[model samples]
Target: MTRSLIIAAKCIAFTCLLLAVVGVSLWSASRRVPKFYEHALTQQLPADELAEAADQLEQEVLDLQSEIQSQETWEVIFTSEQINAWLAADLEQKFPQLLPTGVSEPRVAIEDGLAKVACRYTSPKFSTVFSLELDSFLTETTNEFAIRIAKARAGALPVPLKRFFDQITARAEEANLSVLWTQQEDSPVALVKLPTNLDDVRSDVVIEVIEIEEGQIRIAGRVVPGVELQSMPQQPRFADASQPR
Candidate 1:
């Protein structure tokens, strides 16, 4: 009986040791910053250059707004650098409440048809770089856009989709936007229905293209005379500014 007890204790000790090793490995992974995120953080811009970039982004937005109001075809393109600048400086200064609690220092990288968005996430227990890989396209359904979230991670570790889905839903609710959640090839997709009519201007906005290419995103669409398009609020325009520190 003593021999059996000794063997049982030995087995228990081995199990405990194995669990400890696994726990430590996962902890380490959660703390390791991703290469893309690290590079984004290091590429800083001067204050003057940041302001110039922010101005350029605002100009593009204004132009798009004018075209939409005129009921004319319009196309706008934005570079990754210009967007990063605006996010770093103008967004926090002017719209500090835009981001959720415990999230800050947001940045983006556009490459190979993917837009990588990363931000610092802090919690009571830890702080890490949280990122999402996304791609947007017009769906087959009329006036619908699909924003596919390909992957989400915390530092170097993959994060569960539920947390992100909850956050997205909450944000959409706050903005008074309706989001339909679906899955494509195991990835969660958020379907946003674009308003066909601008109530204030009595026009229809049809978005034909949302293409993401290396280092840039291009949006092309047309507006036509119709009922008011003011059923939904217009998307916020991004302006160039400084890099997030």
Candidate 2:
């Protein structure tokens, strides 16, 4: 073969080897990164194990209950799968009204920093689809969780989620859910007031939604100094409400 042809063949071989190495490196990197949601669920405690954990948690809480009557700070964490399962259960029971009249068996999932809700509603005349992506956070004020819509759609049309804020607030009020909500920046947010009822009022407790990460949320609650958690009448409330007055 000509000298030029020989050099060209050598260059081709070198390029092929370089490509193979890069491909292997990419594959290895992908495998090293964890699949957040799937991994979290896979590590979830089984039914019997979860029950034992819950029992242990309850006992611990009861043991410390008396000592915690005074000011104290506490943090609670729940795995994504556990929380999502509870949310699905709660949607079926506690928030039945959340489903439209014709909708049945709605499904809800909390993961990847958003709550995905889906349901089907049908009527004699027509049918519709309801879907929403929601993200929640806490304002500087204690005891308030603010929910914001990331996206919403209904039956071949895009819906302005913020437009539905008042309706949601009204519905929540009518349902006596003990929540106050309004529109902010053309978006709707619901604030769940703590110390829900007059009779349950206790010490100056400040509970807030602190952080929302890929597979979990962190809630931090604290009691102000010099106050008995069980005796305080009203917990401090968030003022902004993330809405226009």
Candidate 3:
């Protein structure tokens, strides 16, 4: 072939190859984008989908970043997906369990300018048995050891069960669930505080639950005004931090 013709053919081939690469890149990008709700597609997407979207989002973000750097018109950039990731991480860390203080699973919902988490909690068990009639059993231990054994084994142990519901205000505050509070429409997600009537009062002092912050649950109320509270920074010497060795 002639030199010019060969050069032209090579140029055409290179152009076709470049076009193919561009087409493939754009196709890949489009595939990564979710077709669901703009917000969910960005934030609450399932794991695999979120990963794909994240890849695409990262590329787009890089492109946008460059554009912003050069153009100077687009100064601010905030994405729902980014916000969701942060929230998910925080929630996972704070509310890792579903019992004692949290619901089965964290349900995300928004209402009236607040992000409402419809979490559930069941009060811990508290049973006080004044007497199990151990005296009767003790008196006849030898006479009817076999009968007593049979009775204890076959019969239901009298629990004298007493159960009731109570609020989980203590755990909620400790998890910093209050700090994330925000009015609905403030962002892609916000916190809605669940109503709780928890008290810090004891027999000796009158303290009411005021607010929750940091690692401490706040209590503000009359305490006999000048009544000294024995400092308990360190619990009594016999306290156990965990199970008995």
Candidate 4:
């Protein structure tokens, strides 16, 4: 081979080796679940108790099916605490690596009509700490809910969350997390969104948060028919402050 071709081949080989090393490093980082994560999974209800409750729910549904009319609306209530417990359990089981190494487990709450998410983000070097509150409106859809963080407060300063989410997107991609978060538009107020691809579980699921109060959250959904609540495709969903179209 000529000198130029030899140098080109070496460059390609080196590039491939570098990519392989980086891929292995990221895979290793993702495999070691944090020791503290075990605590999050311990809140699941006992199996026998859960089975009994399910049986009761099935019986009640049978009774309702025999007695109730077609247009009746039924709602289920989940307390903020109960929601948080379930959220913690889910993260520990499915997305433990979504929580970065230096950050604490995320906390989710609902106050008024907004969903509040707070976490302490420590720098990788462990030198600086940031307390961040992501405040968003939890819009409801048929299959899943959409969360748009309208504003984020880092300590005392309120800032647009797009940049913070951009950083998270970089890290999450690097760590191979299951969820994808993207800022759909260039505007500062554009929504950071994710598609809840949940077609396998429920064909038509409607989970809408109807009320948010001090300790309770009420969600209304149809369990009978037309369960096609697929998460809407991620698009430009939020309106800019200057252009509310």
Give, for candidate 2, the lowest lDDT window spanning 10 residues: 30-39
* Candidate 2 Cα lDDT to native: 0.57
Ranking by lDDT: 1, 2, 4, 3
What TM-score does structure 1 among the candidates reach? 0.86
What is the per-residue lDDT of model 3 for residues 180-223, given as tens digits with 9 covering 90 to 100?
Answer: 21111211111213222223322222222333232212223333
Residues 53-121, model 2: lDDT tens digits: 545544544543443455466566544555545433445566776666797635445577776665555
- Give the Å error, residue 58, model 2: 11
The clash number for model 1 is 13
- What's every prediction's RMSD, in angstroms? 7.6, 13.7, 29.1, 14.1
Clash counts per candidate, in order, are: 13, 3, 5, 5
Cα lDDT over the full model 1: 0.79
Highest TM-score against the true fold, candidate: 1
Error of 2 at 227 (Å): 6.3
Displacement of residue 105 (Cα, Å) in model 3 is 2.4
Q: What is the lDDT of residue 95 in candidate 4?
A: 69
Cα lDDT, all candidates: 0.79, 0.57, 0.32, 0.46
Model 4 regions more than 4 Å off: 1-76, 83-95, 124-150, 166-203, 208-210, 223-245
Q: Kindly list the per-residue Cα lDDT of model 1 for residues 15-34, writing each as its tens digit.
A: 99999999898888888876
Clashes in predicted model 4: 5
- The TM-scores of all predictions, comma-separated, are 0.86, 0.52, 0.21, 0.42
